[model samples]
Target chain A: MDRFMSLDRRALLAGLAATGVAAGAAALAPRALARTEPGTVLARAIPSSGELVPAVGLGTWITFNVGEDAEARDACVEVVQAFFEGGGRMIDSSPMYGSSQAVIGHALGRLGAAAPFSADKVWISSGSRGPAQIEESRRLWGVSRFDLLQVHNLLSWEEHLETLFAMKAEGRLRYVGITTSEGRRHAEFERIMRAQPLDFVQVTYNPVDREVEERILPLARERGMGVIVNRPFQQGALLRRIGRRPLPPWAAEIGCQSWAQLSLKFILGHETVTCAIPATTSVAHVRENLAAARGALPDAVMRRRIADLFGTL
Target chain B: MSEWWTYALSDFLLFSPRTYYRLFALHNAALWPAHLLALALGLAGVWMLVRPASWHGRALAAGLAAHWLWVAWTFLLVRYATINWGAGYIAAGFVAEAVLLLVLGALGNRIPPATGPGWTGQGGTDMGWPRALGIGLVLFALLLQPLAGPLAGRALAEAELFGMAPDPTVTATLGVLVAAKRIRWEMLAIPLLWCAISGATLWAMEAPDAVLMPAVGVLSLSAALARSFGGRRGTAAG
Candidate 1:
């Protein structure tokens, strides 16, 4: 990622410098300055309660399930610290992610800050296991309360949702939600949004994976539901696809400096998208991720232009 | 999606290739000394296969049993399961395979020498290239499998040597079985199944040297079936 950043800086400077005009360098100066400053990330209000969280969060999937190895654990500690220090508030994890929940606990234990908003999941097929699994997740996170608890991928949604609601009512969870991003599950996810009362909905939405753009986003808006976007980089495939390609010039117009920020900013541009949690083990990528939050978001018109440009790429 | 398509194998994959193999590399690093001892024992078993005797059979079984136990603890239970939950079951299978090998070793002279179309058996001999290839494959599993990791660009400390990593450990065991003349069909069961399972997993992960595992499975199973059902001494005991 340092390698990518060096090449990105060179391209930005060269593109501006090649113009042989002070105006070109002056134009990019503010956005470049904004990139270094903290608390610049865009924040959105959760429709259900008007609580604002940075539109950028950290996800713990495979990147954080590093078991008990001290070296791997230390690497994760660095990433968590980087994300938190970058003004990141939401740190999402789950028990189903093997040791990710535990690794989060390990990282947080090392940090000892007012840790990021704990967003966890209860992912089990049977209703009977929800309590134990959720409890285990809580223990793994070292938190008595989760800011948000989601039914992962909507596995046995009703049973888990009922448990989440009961927990929320009891003050164990500040909010309850359901998650689905697989295109095949969207139909059912849509039905759940209309039928159930939710504070947040975790969904997969990105430049290439715009399947949720049509119905899911609208339903979430119509229902006053907050959206937490996952897989913003399509599990790192997006960055790999955009490898070494210069950032689209217009990305600078939106305070974006890297493809990571561009991909994240594109998602945050949507009014319904309260946040997009892009997971990364590299602290450099974490800095790149939080930097996406600071800049001006593309409006609906610019979003389309961004989408069209992304399509061409 | 259909109601049944809730979760597929692809959904479970959360880590990247670097993270996945790095786990193996770390597993190898933490258990540095074990690799030397497991490899020496595995090579000894390979050597004993050439000089067939009841004692060699017993020693080979005990050696493989030891390797299986170590792999289950260090590779599967201790390391691999951290990323992939399916590894717990794989660990159990390794333990079961170890027990089966111990049972085979305890059977004494009943364990037969290497036999097939090209090798000596109870009532017949039909030495062929299959026997030669089987020996070569087994030797490859023990001696050459360790190099797969380094060759794929990982460091030497991260190399997945036999007796330390499950893939090479199981593959080498299957190879040794293929090179053997007479062993219970039950003895071949778990390792072959594991080869298929591990192969499918590595393929899904897009791991380096993934194809070799299932290749060993297919080649060994074909040889076992040919020597057993396609022989004059098919029903005869050692």
Candidate 2:
């Protein structure tokens, strides 16, 4: 009876948050219902476990790796807070990014008891480092277990993959996967995907760098694997190139108020993409990215249209 | 993975040009006017190169040692380390280089670099052009490299200085050191390597001046090597 009462109260609060988000969306685009409950409106389904997660997540590569600076740390705190308040869950990070894991934990600690979909990576060289690194990641995130554990950049993957699979079986991690960036080592990445039973795979794909679209995306779709797209803004190069160009008249037709939303929505329009992790230092940019996850996703035609428009820019 | 391989410098960086320049800006703003003083010292060292005395080489080395130390503390330690973890160790390299230069400078007339260019069987002819080039380089470090910010769309307030910033500091030092009468091949190792590393980093970021960096490093290295040893002296004017 007590559990039931708590669930009801949580639902009520989520409904309020959803209403607020809906009202905010009204200012920007046509009203389309998001495929989620009140707060988790733009969530996507993970193919392996059928677990739902938000379609837009945060990446901590360079944006969140500001070391030991108080002003930067406080600003990151605000970004993380705004991310959660807008229904984001998957906060992806790696130890390669110095100080990002700690900052995420620092931010997570501030919002006690919120169920965050913790997805982290095992980023260490060979030897008995696999387990120790995983333990360190857990300690850093202040969580007992990670929802997803990927082998970062396929470094020592044969050894690390075995360790990750063992941990998943042992219930230390909920999912096991491998990742690579910029389509580098793609042949090897493809071979691993074919051989290993990975639950998730991260690849760098954006409107500009579409090499992954040829094989990797289709392969993930065929293999029932969840895909995470990194470098959605090409590490801010694409946006910087676009500068402050006016958004197209047709952008409102697809519910994109900002170019960030347009770019992310193009990535999400594909059926295989589970999420896109676009890292940003600005809290306002975080809101813009989260909004991309909601409302409308384009069909194949609309997706190509986005490509053409982006190309001309 | 089928085969394990060592990663290159480009592998680690998913770099952005905007962010890279902003790093320079942050560094420049943090350590203002130190660049100016480094420039002044650098000019004096260059002038010494053009007209050398018995103790001028030691004075030049002392000046370079101080500039290298400043770069180690300000740019690498405080600024670059914030973004790149490898910078901390790289700072140690700069410190080591400074100590070596300082010790070499203090040891008095023993160092080979002390005997100004024409001494010890070195063919110092064609020095007119190289000397002119050397003067330009030293002044560039002091006067022009900071001003180069505007060309790159960077503001004057965020201008990186000669003594404080690594590139101009190293470039300017090479400008003078390479012109020193009897060149020292051993002393150029660390600075050249730093130039190469920083060049590769900028290349990975696709910065506009990426080509110029290693070009200068290689050219300076070649010029220094050519004049350092194994050449017969010419009767041409110094």
Candidate 3:
């Protein structure tokens, strides 16, 4: 944690070199400025309660499954600490991702009252098993209740959603949603989005995979459900696919330093997106991701431009 | 069920290669000096394979049984299960294999020693291609398999040794089974399954040496089948 603090301080001192430069300055010192000036991450309103959450939250899919290795576990702690310091609140995990929920619990235990917006999922096939799984997730997270709980991959979703809705009604859970990824079962997902009174919907959305842009995003907007974008980097495949390719010059206009930030900015640029959860293992990456939420999201033209350029790449 | 077909092998791999190797590193560190004992047992297995005496074969089976149980507990159940949710199932398989090996060893003298075409058996005669392949495999598992980590850009500390880690242990067991005059289907079942499982796992991690494990399984199983059928043909000719 202290290592990241010094990194921020070092970036801050670098940013202080160029003063009073208004327009092009953000592009010049995106990292330095974002590091020095904390609490500037763009916040979006959850359509259900109008409560704001940072547009860029941490996702723990493959990143946080370190599993009992003390050093790797501590490295995860640094990532969560860096996220909290970068003004990130929501941290998402699933019961399907082995040991991730426990690692998050360990981090939360270490960070004691870091005020995270905890989100987890109940992924069992049995409806009767749903409550026990969710309770186990809660125990693993060491939280009294999760801010949001989703039906993972819509496995036995109908039964899980009922339990989630009941939990929400009982004040045991704050919000209820359903998740699907890799664009699997979108028709079923959209059907549930229309049928259920869901508060949130987590789905895969990146520059390359834009299936949701046509129907799901528009429907989420129509249904007034907050949208959480998962797989913002396609589980790092997108970034690896764009390997070492220079960022487009227009990226600076949106305060994007790396392809990761550009990919995140593209997702968050959409009006319907409440948050984009990009999972990472590095604290520098967490800080860089949080920086994407800070300033100047791409407009409609810029977003199409990004999508077009990504297709070419 | 049709939806399940859409899923790829990589989707189920929840941990990274780095984390996977580090698990071994940590496991090896915690179980210091036991690696030497595993190596000694591996050498003993090789001796039994080459000698082909009834007592030696029985002792080898008991040694392998003990190794399977130890690996099932220490590595699979305690260590690998941390990252892989399916590891407990694999551990159960290992335990079952251990029990079968124990049964085979306990009923030693009742089962006749091999006298077929390639049978080195109590005669202590020259082992044909099957036993030769078996000895090569056991030696590779004992001496060469550990270096795979270092060769594949992993730390030497993370080296998976025979009898200690599942991959090399299974590989060595297949070697011993293939070397024997007769292949017991019950004893061969679990190690072969583990080979397929381990191969898929390493493939998902994009490890370059992923093919090596399953290749060992296929090669050994093929040799065993050839020897078994060839022995029947030799008997008919005689």
Tens digits of per-residue lDDT, candidate 3, A108-183, equal 9999977788989999999999999999999999998999999999999989999999999999998999999988
Give one digit per residue, the lDDT tens place, for model 1 in A1-313. Answer: 0000111323333433443332333333333121322345555556665555666899988789777767878999999998877667799988778889999998888888655778999888998899999888888888877899999888888898999899888888888898876565787888899999998999888877899999988888888888999999888777887789997677788888888788787897776788899998899999999888774777777778877877777
Ranking by TM-score: 3, 1, 2
| Better TM-score candidate (1, 2) | 1
Model 2 residue A202 CA deviation (Å) reads 1.0
- The CA-based lDDT of model 1 is what? 0.75
What order do you get sorting by DockQ, best first? 3, 1, 2
Q: Candidate 3 on B1-238: residue-level lDDT in tens?
A: 3288778899889898988989899989999899998899888777766555657667777788889999999998888888878889999999998888778754552212233346533553433677678788999999999998889888999999988899888888888777665667777878888888889999999998899889998998887787667644322211
TM-score of each: 0.87, 0.79, 0.90
lDDT of candidate 1 over B1-238, digit per residue (tens): 3455666655657665666777777887777787778778877766676655546767777777888998898888887888778889988988998888887654553344464453343453433444556667768877787788788667776677788887777777766665556545787889888887777666767677778778888888887777666643543344
Candidate 3, position A62, lDDT: 81
Estimate candidate 2's RMSD in Å. 6.8
> Model 1 chain B, TM?
0.85
Cα-based RMSD of candidate 3: 7.3
Ranking 2 against 3 by DockQ, winner: 3
Model 1, runs deviating above 4 Å: A1-39, B1-9, B108-111, B115-127, B182-184, B231-237
User: Candidate 3: lDDT of A158?
Assistant: 86
